[model samples]
Target: MSERPNYETMYILRPDIAEDEVETHTNKYRDLVIENGGTIIDNQQRGKRRLAYNIGKHREGVYVQLNYSGDGKQVGPLERAMRLSEDVIRYLTVKYEGQHSSLGRSTTPVAPMESSAPRQDRDLVGAAAAIPAASDDD
Candidate 1:
């Protein structure tokens, strides 16, 4: 028997939807996954946020993310439902092979360290000084 693979689906809904309808939409997709033989790992409602660009005259959307595992068969019906629904504006599904993917894990990003040396001094000290300047001679 083949091992089930991990998948994450993120869909955006119309920001104008009611809270109850949002819950209904989330449950419908969750149930669809279960009915199609997929195991749910994580489901997150990321709340309403501004879109990077306008979609169908709207400037924002409701985001929902679903992480699950299955034999890859469940994707079609799930995506089809979103494509046909007026409530959903956009959606994407990504497959992960193993634990390398940081799904379901919360992590705080570390800030980058700043250099101690001054930028002007550092630029003139090494290879920058050895490079010849451009000339107009042909």
Candidate 2:
């Protein structure tokens, strides 16, 4: 068996669906991923929000995000299910390239060096000071 790769999926559902039906749809997709040999790390329901533009005449959608680990072959079926579902307005899946922290974020934080003034700013200031001021005699 191939090693499982980390993946994240975000999907938007039709806003007209009831809360209970939304839960059911969410569970259905989760189960589909698990059944296809994926292990879910996290699942988040972002709730209803307005869409950027009209889709199938929908002005709003309910967003859900799922993080999991699975082999490359598993994605096709999962995406197919979403594509065929009438309630799904849009969906996207992304494979993570490198190691991720427990919450799927980068473990290392990039920090800028502490200084009174950055090198570029200091150079600009010095250049301005070097220019001689104009006089009325000239």
Candidate 3:
């Protein structure tokens, strides 16, 4: 039987590198995942964008997100690659929770998640939940 899948991992890369370098770095990790017997659900390029704060003297970066299904072990090498890669200035990997779906399957492409900026979803939810009830001022 196939091993049970765990969490999803996504990361960003430094844009200052040549475009080819981006492809190389991305491919390397992809191969690593495959070699480790994991299935890659989606490998997405979120494109370049300005950073909210400086990371390793970088003002912007080429963001990438990987939606994968694999054993927990794959997370370490995924992160190790990020650390060793010179073209990647910053990266964060989050584990999806509570019946979460793996991002985009092969047949369908979902919109890339925005990187290097604030996410609106959290704020929107907070705002909606904080609405005050109407009061009888009169």
Q: Point out the higher-scoring one by TM-score: 1 or 3.
A: 1
Candidate 2: the clashing residue pairs are none
lDDT of 1 at 32: 99
Residue-by-residue lDDT tens digits, candidate 2, 110-131? 6987989746778888999999
Model 3, which residues run further than 4 Å from truth? 1-3, 97-138
For model 3, the local distance difference test gives: 0.74
lDDT of 1 at 39: 96
Cα lDDT of candidate 2 equals 0.87
Candidate 2 error regions (>4 Å):
1-3, 98-104, 108-138
Between the candidate structures 2 and 3, which one is better when assessed by lDDT? 2
Tens digits of per-residue lDDT for model 3, 10-116: 66787777888888877988888788777876777778988888887788888887766777677788889888977778777665533344433233346797699
User: TM-score of each candidate?
Assistant: 0.72, 0.71, 0.65
Name model 1 segments beyond 4 Å from true. Answer: 100-138
